[model samples]
Target: MTTQVVILAAGMGSRLGRSLPKPLTELSDGRTIMQQQFDNIHHAFGKRAKVTVVVGYKLEHIVEAFPDASFVYNEQYDQTNTSKSLLRALQASQPGGVLWMNGDVVFDPRVLDRAAEMIARDQSFVTVNTAKVSDEEVKYTTSAEGYIQKLSKTVKGGLGEAVGINYISAADKAMLVRHLQRVDAQDYFERGIELAIEQNRILVEPVDISDLYAVEVDFAEDLDRANLFV
Candidate 1:
């Protein structure tokens, strides 16, 4: 099966305070953030990777920037959050597992290489960095069986921080879609994952990539840190 990927870039990214979409922000390497993501995908999966970008805010800019990529528009992007954007992408995807990442993340291409095994097995997973856990970042706790138990920004006793790179197996995608549809409009996509885990027993493993850099550029400092890796 071809490797399917989705990039959630519909938000206005108000925290970054940029006129352009966050994914369009230029990195020190002179590649836009999304361009680097595309490069990483191609490096890992070659021509077999089918990328679908979820666009809304300044959709035209993103569409023009990557003419080859497929796009799904989130008409309610301004009124919703990642949950809705993700739902739109999931609903539009083909019959297969999907690997997705935040549009604003700047990371080592090796991160995707690290996830290759899980992708090949079609296992649902979330990339995590065990080196640091910030209060503002999405954090997670593992179950007794070593799968992800709870995931959210407010998760207490979190074992690590989620790096915003994730996968939903084709087997688990419909359950996640149902939960994503039921989540609040302002809820992050993590909420949907949590619901699926709690109610449906969907197992999502945590893929540790602490040694690799995966920074979501939300502020000026974040951009600075991401530039260091680029």
Candidate 2:
């Protein structure tokens, strides 16, 4: 089966203050953030990867930049959050596992190489950076069994920060979709993952990638930090 991948690029990204979609923002290396993500995906999965980007704000810009990618438009992008965008992508996907990342994240391709083992085992996971846990970023804590328990911005005693790279196995995809629907429109996709763990007992492991560079570019400072890695 082909490896399904989704890039959530519909948000207006007002924080970044860029006219183009955040993913299209040019990096120091001249490759856009989305371009680096595509290169990483291809390097990790080769021709087996089927990428679907969820587009909205300035959708045409992204559409023109990556002509080969499949897309799903989120009409309510301005009114909704990642939960809705991710929900749409999941709905459009075939009955299989999916690997997704926030469009603005610029990371070392080796991050995906680290995740390849978990993907092969069909396990659900969230890539994390244990080196830092900022109050603004999504954080998480694991259950006694070492599976992710609490996952959100307000998680107390957070073990690490979720780096916006995640996977949902085929077995857990439907449940995640149902939880995504239940979350509020303003809620991040992490809320749905929390609900799934709380209600359905889905096991989501935290794959630590602190040794690797994975930065989600939201502010100018973040872009600066990400550029250092690239």
- Measured by lDDT, the strongest candidate is 2
lDDT of each: 0.95, 0.96
Scanning candidate 2 in windows of ten residues, the lowest lDDT window is 113-122
Off by over 4 Å in 1: none
> Candidate 2: which stretches are off by over 4 Å?
none
Q: How many clashes in candidate 2?
A: 0
Cα lDDT for residue 115, candidate 2: 88
Estimated TM-score per prediction? 0.99, 0.99
Candidate 2 matches the true fold with a TM-score of 0.99
User: Against the correct fold, how does model 1 do in TM-score?
Assistant: 0.99
